[model samples]
Target: MDRSKQLYEQDATDWQRGMYEDIKTTFRAPIVNWYFRSLTANEPAFTRYLWGQLKPLFQTRAFGRYAVSYRDTVLSAIEDGPADLPRYRRADTALRPAEWRELRGQLATFDVVAPRLALTFAVCDRAMHGDLPDANPEGAPSTAPLPPWLDRDRGQSVTMLEAGDVPGDLSETVDEIRAFHGLEEGLPSIYRCLAQWPGYLEPAWTDLEPILESEAFERGCRDADAVVDGHLEELPYTPRLSPNDLAEQGFDDETIDDIQHYVRAFNRGAVSKVLQTIVTYAATLDAGGERSL
Candidate 1:
């Protein structure tokens, strides 16, 4: 076998092994388990639903690799510093007040909205390719066509985010994409509680009375096409929630403030650690490195 092919195979094998071990030991068995337990104690159904949602994320090699690659890309962008970063559209000007309010309402329903969309993408992508490892799924799949919702000039007026558009609220963007995929409704109440509580324990009883009583919200929840289209129509230009708004919506203000305070701390620490390990490995590649390449 060619030396380059041998090296590539070795690297792929090592990556797969390491990723599987890390996910099973660190992510699936412990962190995710604990997260679900804490967030979904009351909602057994929601807990089960979330596990179902995460099954593909845990099982798929493509998703595992994508997580690491996306982290690296973000770290690299951070290292490049603010001046070199691409200009993102200002959320304040991009969306009007009524539009922002609508987006917020959608976001309030995000727990159900996001995971469904992710599932749709996963299913569609897998169906198209027969569960084969994506040729280049580190970020977005280059071969897979953009979803129908994102097509430009389609009379839907959806915002098409460029590859580098870094929004202020990463979570919200994720939720919006989930909503676009028709996977965003009829999620179990426990899943809803998990969305509300996240790492913390949820309240024993959810006030489902409002949701059950509201004809409009219930109808919106039921109409999958309308919900998807509504989100798509507003995507072309929507405002991210401000920090105060985020706090009001139950995210930890102190944590967000602290992270904002030290924007590059993780890049300088965790990311640099990974890069240093890579450099050390590279240094050991003697003169034959060039020939091998």
Candidate 2:
């Protein structure tokens, strides 16, 4: 399989695709997370090896409950940071009920999934890098079930747009996103996924572009990581996927470290930023501001 085409979910195996959908259904997300996409770029062998062992952990009924709770703690990490971002509502459009529903679903999906995935990537990054997380944090976060309002819409799945599928018209926007990341690591999945809803993209970029270039926003990411990291500290992370395990599985130091690069980049660079943006977007919508666009 070509490395370029591998970024899309459509090219994966049936079982691999099923696993991807299972994750989406569990998290109520409309898209394949970049973590899995990056992992499966090579015929799903490494991904299958890693996730097969980890699936049982997610299958535990308690895991979903814990994930929802953990998400809240992650959001709290930087919920109050300065966006310094002007709201860019759709200027020429009024959302129909259906559009509103989809928009709401999209926002809600990220609200939960972003943070949960953030913690997951964090654990995997540390594990692969030989940084053992504490079995329990100094103050572990609660694992309470989500409240009725928070748990309401589980969100319908949508067609995920790949990098190559981005419209020619949006090339400039994609360029801006690349510039925002400042590391040439590849555009964030949030941008590509949200581009499916251009109306939302208008506002999302409006808010994110400025903040992504600023000093305070970086600090906010660190702030959020502190909170999420504190909670994740308590994860009883398995050593099966650690550096030692990868080494035993025939991966050399460089190979193991390469995996860590993807994990760590997605964990620190994309996941938390996407979470904060989604949280802020949800807050704006819920406030019932000017309705049009």
Name the top lDDT candidate.
Answer: 2
TM-score of 2: 0.71
Q: Clashing residue pairs, candidate 1?
A: 159-236
By summed lDDT, the worst window of 10 consecutive residues in model 1 runs over 284-293
Question: Where does model 2 exceed 4 Å of error?
Answer: 1-14, 53-93, 137-153, 160-175, 183-186, 207-219, 250-257, 268-272, 287-293
lDDT of 2 by residue, 113-217 (tens): 665576667777777777756455222223333333433345555545777888787777778766655536555555666777766666567665665556655
TM-score of each: 0.23, 0.71
Give lDDT for model 2. Answer: 0.58
Query: What are the per-residue Cα lDDT tens digits for candidate 1 across 1-293?
Result: 11111111123244333433443332322112122233233333332333443344423433333333322332243333322222212252255555544333322232212223323333322222233232323333322322222211211111223323433334453354234323343322223322332211111112222322244323323332233222222221122223543355455655445323232332222222222212111111110011110
Q: Model 2: how far is 230 from its true place, Å?
A: 1.0
CA lDDT for candidate 1:
0.28
Superposed Cα deviation of residue 222, candidate 2 (Å) = 1.9
Instruction: Give me the candidate number with maximum TM-score.
Output: 2
